[model samples]
Target: MSGCVFCRIVAGSVPSFQVVGEPSGVAFLDSRPVFRGHVLVVPRPHLETLTDLPEADLAGYFGLVRRVAAAVESGLDAGGTFVAMNNRVSQSVPHLHTHVVPRTKGDGLRGFFWPRTRYDDDGQAATYAARIGAAVAPPTRG
Candidate 1:
């Protein structure tokens, strides 16, 4: 956590193009922008992954992300938005964070376009969404 770059940003040891800074979280423009108005939202506390974060912190972190997304949408006139986060195996910073990207029609950002069998109908898509949603539901205790 001490050596982590995001931690340093949160600690004010490093400079960032910060957009929003709150007691629970911070939002900043991404140096490596996937699209214009790209932002990164992170909790103040050091956390390696979403599972490592306390529920309250995680909620507050995403709440900030949503707020940033809204700002980007209105300011940039983006047609859509992409929100993402990578865990240990795919993370670059080794710290928990979310990416809020303002997407346009021809952004050239192809997400998860793996070759796969096509779904037969809307039922298949609905079923897939429902299952994934249930699996990712927040802990009942939290």
Candidate 2:
């Protein structure tokens, strides 16, 4: 896991625009965002691909992801959110990460053809992270 970028980010060795840092996982702004407030949620420990995730970790990891999706929508004042995960195919980092992207009507995003965008600077990225981070509420059990 030493060479894993997600592991480095989770370990605080590699800097990222972190939104949620918790026992369950870490959520951060995607460097190449599909939208300004796009966030990627990954488990605290390294796990490559979704199937690699253990059954015991499912609830906690997904609870974190659910919270992030809500935060992205509410914090960014977006109409809704698009949450997705790529297993082995098109799995850019070879890490178990879920993408939570803010979406609004008429945004022009269609299907899987995601056109990536960048923040104006690190400050801009941080701003996005802070916005979503602030709105993220503590997880509640059903």
Predictions in order: lDDT: 0.68, 0.94
Off by over 4 Å in 1: 112-142
Task: State which candidate has the highest lDDT.
Answer: 2
Name the regions of candidate 2 deviating beyond 4 angstroms.
Answer: none
Q: lDDT by residue for model 1 over 104-138, one digit each (tens)?
A: 89767787431223344545434432332232222
Model 1 alpha-carbon miss at residue 81, Å: 0.8
The weakest ten consecutive residues by lDDT in model 2 span 44-53
> Clashes in model 2: which pairs?
none
lDDT of 2: 0.94
Q: Write the per-residue lDDT of candidate 2 for residues 1-142, one digit (tens) a residue.
A: 8999999999999999999899999999999999999999999888988888899989999999999999999999999999999998899998899999999999999998899999999999999999999999997767
